[model samples]
Target: MAKLRTTFVCSNCGYSSPKWSGQCPGCREWNTMNEEVEEKTKVSAVSSVKSKTVFSSVSSVTEISTGDELRYNTGIGELDRVLGGGLVKGSVVLLSGDPGIGKSTLLMQACGTFSRDKTVLYVSGEESAKQLKLRAERLNVNSDKLFVMTETDVESICEYIKVNKPEVVMIDSIQTMNNAEIQSSPGSVTQVRECTNLLLRTGKSLDIPVIIVGHVNKDGAIAGPKVMEHIVDAVLYFEGERNYAYRILRAVKNRYGSTNEIGVFEMGDGGLSEVENPSQALLSERNVNVSGNCISCVMEGSRPILAEVQSLVCTSGYGNSRRMSTGFDFNRLSLILAVLEKRFGYRFSGMDTYLNIVGGLKLDEPAADLPVALALVSGFTDKPVPDDVVAIGEIGLSGEVRSVSRISARISEAARLGFTKCIVPRSCLKQIKTKADIEVIGVRNLHETIANVF
Candidate 1:
């Protein structure tokens, strides 16, 4: 019998320390350190000699080989677009989202695509084989080459991967998988790190693409070490309200593709269907000729989308005024209010103001700035901005309209949505041309823009 070795590890950042501390210096998380004990096993002289030879033979540094472009197209347009054209062989992708956000459904379809042309393995620790089959049957997509396995042990999963040598392998969730070498639960810090490391090694060594689904924490981020995201090739985030049918797959980080790309998906009985023309869905809830509502053009990566910006302004009571916002940024709303007061001479400080973007999509693009500002002003003055008028441009502190990214795309989206007029930066005037259906209006400042519109 040998002595037991133990160490304290921080669950937040995977910080390891010899002794337990009240505050983790590594991650600054309070009281997150947990003690993990490992049993020591004595190795014979012959075993130590064999271990040195094995360790020396395992190469740590190797050249990264790029995957073929043809294999990157997975038949799913939105997914492929987000993945920077397609799946790269030997790449590890981590897709994380809140529970019940169709993480499983999306991966099922990805597996189904490869199983038709090549061998694919769909490994799940959360669901049974029968359950996965039921989902596949309901979706009317069941492939013979798509093998389903329910296991959480890392060693056995590695053995399965070695035996099958499939073209692609997907783990339903990396959170639930654990390595036998770690003395912790399936989703603990130790297990997650080790499981991810092993999978990454396997993917690189065997040249098989691995996509792992991850669970999100309460703060709406992946529930694991930050290293988990860095260790993988790409980090995909699945977002959208469960009540709403539309779901978005956004790539926050990618090694093989651009991070700005997003994949739009609509959930239905048949599973998730890709929205080819996503702009149409963003403006589907708008009502024509409505007061306090304006069509706003926003840039999604390089693409443009038209969304409805609604604002409600009313006199306040008691002592304080209220400011509330939905989908759009709250800080930007505050700046817009200041512009309305200083530039438009409208005293909105004493009023209750609420700004709303019709759909649940979150946007930070500067193109929505002018529309949001105008929507608030339109609500305050009780003036209905013309139904055909669309706003696009960024607003500055001096009430000057700033240039936005991809103005041409924004103007085109507004016109495609049947908006006759667009208020954009004067610099964009050169790029915008006269169209029969839509009229593009260029403005340089806030006063000139408001006076012309009013």
Candidate 2:
């Protein structure tokens, strides 16, 4: 056999180089280059074949046909909500999470629903057919229309799709699938890109929705080339500790619907069960009269969720005080501490502080800012915040309380959860016209909030 030419490729940024380099110039990372077999192609033979571009006249928006039915339900309400109603036909979705994060189980459960009326094909590249069967049996997913095949070759999977013509298809994982035409390995950039391209073409051409599972790196981002995320119609991430029973499904990108929507599920012995009332589930284990604990209402999409923010403040023995946060941004915590120290003259300089959001739910929005500040101050002063009170506002650098969006929804959720008092921004208070069952108090700054809460 003739010598097969090879080239060095950067695994991180997918930049190719003629020779080896200790550091990749593209991403400026050290020693990420790997040698891969380079397939030589005869370009002269195909140069004469010119592909003509076809153009069509643009039509009015009213003329466009959005069929009678645009989406199909996955039979799981929470999953359907996260998917922006239901799975859009001909739309490609990429689902990624850590190892054993119930990605496969969730997809399999959706498959069982799709197989009820529509033919569904599940192409697994990781697990064997028997292994899948046993797992399916354990999950109690039985459907005659659900077909399972264990294959890694992208070409073979395409062939199966063409022959079966299933209404919905799922690739167990994109990393495991490979295109024979690509000289690189299965999980390499070239193979993953080509395989996803093939699947995208197949799904679009057949008007079938395709769901591809992805692997996440140690940094909690989807593994493989960054372009993989851009090529898909939607990107869903599974979040929550593996040790915890609850899992959150959030959409980072969605072409058909809002990305703010989230799906809550509790991993049980049978399968994942949807948590209809997530706020209740999240605040069920709250201990009353705790010095460092405070309730906050944060809006997740259109849904209002009540979360517990806990803080611990103690005098630091070390020279440099340590600050730690779980399910909360560390930089945000530091900024809040700075505001408290500079504006209010409260010293957290010699203290070690820790913050945590209960139920493994991350507080990404600014609405939790005031509650976190309250929790921190409460911990430092060794005073318990009112148990029946829920805080909702954003803290500014000048120690002023700022208004948050969907303030009405947040207060309403807090009221429904049996909270008697709600502390909100003064600006947001004017927006509420009707009287709620709960007592609403508006504060202009953090000092007024501290006076009212403790």
Candidate 3:
């Protein structure tokens, strides 16, 4: 034997220390450090062909590159878009979401894509094969190669993968899989990390794509050690309110492509349906031809979306006015209010101003500023803007209508949503010509926008 070493690792954030402390420095958890054994032994191989593989993108003995030419399709467009176009081979992806929010639905759909064309083994730790079958039947999914195995033992799952040589493997959940090497309970920090590590190695050695779904904590974050995310090649967050019908798949990390992209999906009876154009679904059918409602066009990544903004302003009976905003940035709302007080001198401090973006959509783009302020003005004066009109432009502190990104995309999306008129930055006017029927009003400054809207 060469040597034996022991160390304490924080179960919360994977902070390893020489010894245990009363509190962990990584996640500030109390008494979470657990000791583990490490045995240094000679390398033994049961099967060996070569020490290196081209698919791994390893340049030398120790260091490796991940940008190898490997991208496998998961067979879902929305999932593909959220995953930066496809899955990176030998990468571990963590899929997380709220319970009953279709995390399993999305993963099952992914397996169905490969099950018909390629071999995929779905190791389910929580649901049985029969249970999974029922769900698949309900989804009306047909797959010949998607094998489902109900087991929680990490060792057995590894053996199955080694014997079956699957192209793609999905663990329904990582929390339920526990390694015998670790004595902790399944779903504990130690077991989650070790099981993930084993799967990580299996993915690299077998050149197979492995995806692990995890339950989120109460904080709406990934459960288990934060290092679980660090060890993976990609981290995807399946988000959106369950009460609402829509689900938003967001990518936090990607080694193969850009992470800024997002996938939109809607929850339905059969399964999750990919929303091709989600902007239309987010707008209200009830016409907003009244005060406190304004339309704004914004873009997430390359996709353009139209969002409705509503605001309320009234006289403040107290010493200071109350400014409340939902589905929008608070700071942006404050800036708009300040401009109304400073530049326009509207004296809004003596008023209670409430702002909201309709359809429960959160607006972060500065281009929404124009419509947000307009909605406030509409609410204060109780004047309704044109129902068919929409606006897109960033508002400055000095009331200038700044140009926004992808103006053409925004205009196109708005037009697709049947908006009759578009108010855009004058700077973007030269790049795009308005449609024959729809009118495009170009404004250079906030003064011009206010003058045009009112």
Ranking by TM-score: 2, 1, 3
Which TM-score value belongs to model 1? 0.88
Q: Model 1: which ten-residue window has the lowest total lDDT? A: 218-227
Q: What C-alpha lDDT do the candidate models reach, one value each?
A: 0.81, 0.87, 0.80
Candidate 3: segments with Cα more than 4 A from true spot: 1-69, 219-226, 314-322, 433-437
Clashing pairs in 1: 72-86
Give a tens-digit lDDT track for model 1, residues 351-382: 99998887678768877888888888789888
Q: Please provide, for model 2 over 1-454, each residue's C-alpha lDDT reduced to its tens digit, 9 standing for 90 to 100.
A: 4346788877667778989888878888777776777766523111222232123335788997877778999999998999999999999999988889899999999998889899999999999999999888978989899999899999899888988899999999998998876677777766776688788878876789999998875331123535488889999998898888889999999999999999999999888889999999999899999899999999898999999999999999999999999988999999999999999887999999999999999999999999999999999999999899899999999999999998888888888989999999999987986466999999999999999987
Error of 1 at 248 (Å): 0.7
Residue pairs in collision within model 3 = none
Clashing pairs in 2: none
Candidate 3 lDDT by residue in tens digits, 236-304: 888887788888888888776678788888889888999887777888564666787899887776788
**Against the correct fold, how does model 3 do in TM-score?**
0.83
Name the lDDT of candidate 1. Answer: 0.81
Give the distance in Å from residue 269's predicted Cα in candidate 2 to where it truly belongs. Answer: 0.6
